[model samples]
Target: MSKSNTNTRTQTRASLFTPFIAIILPVIIASAVLYRLDPLEPVHFPLDKINRSAITVPLLNKNMRLGSEKAAEGQVLGPEDLVYDAALGVVYTGCEDGWIKRITVNESVVEDWVNTGGRPLGLAFDGNGDLIVADAYKVTGFHIYV
Candidate 1:
């Protein structure tokens, strides 16, 4: 109510807020600097540098859904190790559901191709044009399915 009392209250509020700002500003700046120095597993691989002369793998994002979209579509559980069949113009991915899914990159068409009876953990095509599937089961853990 009195002028001296109001001024004292304003000074006290300003003193409290100034210290908070001084403390928080350095913390904010230090956090930014540290993050710029070493952040999480940042995607350092540029899209252009991927799959050219040296052959960049998976950086080719055409109709590719990164991982989540295909996994959601057609029950492609735990899709792993995408092996591109360049000759066939399709990508094959092993899933945890004991199946290999063939995906047409341009069309985004997913087909349930082969079931390994065990979890298809990895997929690759051999020189003989046969798909070599590493099916991992609970007991044995490894089996080659061709």
Candidate 2:
């Protein structure tokens, strides 16, 4: 609380960041130089030749909506951003219905995963396969940890 103690605390916090900068600064500088030095030719595809296949999922052409009605059984509504779990073959999405829905891509099954009690706007899966949601009107972003 006093001036000397506050100064020491500030210095301690500044020193804590020093080691991180020291370790990362050289790597960053070296990466910038190496990135500029690397030999790589620019690629330019013809305007007419580029198709959805050029930069999309392998099965992006599949009509996922045709059978979604039967799969969802009228559960999913206003689905927002989704995260696909390749290992689980499922996609988690936030919905305007105030629930997070899990759709089993392989089986075409829809299940209400969680009730956020508010309009869920975005969805993501953490490293441990847990779902994260962004509830609307919360004044927050996708970084909501829990």
Q: Record all residue pairs in model 2 with backbone atoms less than 3 Å apart, i.e. clashing.
A: none
Which candidate comes out best when scored by lDDT? 2
lDDT of all predictions: 0.76, 0.78
**Per-residue lDDT tens digits of candidate 1, residues 11-75?**
99999999999999999999999989995786678867766666557967786655544333655
Predict model 1's lDDT versus the native: 0.76
Q: Worst lDDT window (10 residues) for model 1?
A: 137-146
Estimate the overall C-alpha local distance difference test score of candidate 2.
0.78
Task: List candidate 1 segments past 4 Å from native.
Answer: 1-75, 138-146
lDDT per residue (tens digit) for residues 1-146 in model 2 = 79999999999999989998999999999999999999999988887775545555775766767755445546678888878888888877788877778899878788887777788887777776666677886666444333
Q: What is the lDDT of residue 96 in candidate 2?
A: 87
TM values, all candidates? 0.44, 0.44
In candidate 2, stretches whose alpha carbon ends up further than 4 angstroms from where it belongs are 1-74, 139-146
